[model samples]
Target: MALAYDDTNIFARILRGEIPCDKVAENDHALAFRDINPQAPVHVLVIPKGAYVSLDDFAANASDAEILSFTRLCAQVCTSEGVHLAGGHDGFRAIANAGPHGVQEVPHYHLHILGGRVMGPMLARKA
Candidate 1:
């Protein structure tokens, strides 16, 4: 039997075309779509095609080649999206949250590529 993974979640639905999304990029191994609740001027989420759950899950489930391809796609997206800037802290920030402690809203393993301006920390900072 095949390995188990929940494919009924929202992002998984988007991956399966059960839900429509503002698609930014896609490859055989991954798909990139815009964030519905964008935190930055350019906020896109990249997910592995067969992702069943969180990064922890994906990490455990995905093959080594899959992981490598994911990293390559991350670089590719950064390039294609014009997120790579010359100066430090001037480009996009790729984020993959593992679980609740990591602020992962969606269960699927997804990376938030946020850029287009100076970005702050993920958490609210005290004054």
Candidate 2:
């Protein structure tokens, strides 16, 4: 089932211009901006202009154009941030945290781009 879209979410507010954001890049279908509470040296949040609660919701409910545009915008963000180097070892990580288990703070689906330095593993080892 498709999740209800929450317009009150911060991302929704940002997209609607109800809230201000430090925009980094924008395309016809998506917006890229710096994270207020960054977890990495280079942290950016990319989200589709469309309303979707989670990645699953986005994948199932969003249009093909929106899907393509969102993914393309993500690649653009990595490139623009200078973390994704071509023909080199330099690379970046794009993450989409979903639901409570994934620690998704916002109800809206978004991608986090992190790089510019060596990153640790996605999870810590169990002691």
Per-candidate clashes come to: 0, 0
lDDT, candidate 2, 1-127, per-residue tens: 3446778999999988999999999999999999999988899999999888889988988999999999999888888888887757488788998887888888899999999888879789999
State the displacement of the C-alpha of residue 16, model 1, in Å, after optimal TM-score superposition. Answer: 1.2
lDDT of 2 at 86: 79
lDDT of each: 0.78, 0.89
Instruction: Evaluate model 2: give its TM-score.
Output: 0.92
Q: Best candidate, lDDT-wise?
A: 2
The best candidate by TM-score is 2
Candidate 2 lDDT (Cα, 0 to 1) = 0.89
Model 1, 1-127: lDDT tens per residue? Answer: 2324566789888877899999877877888888999998878888998765667677787988788777788777777777876444368887788665776666778889999887877679889
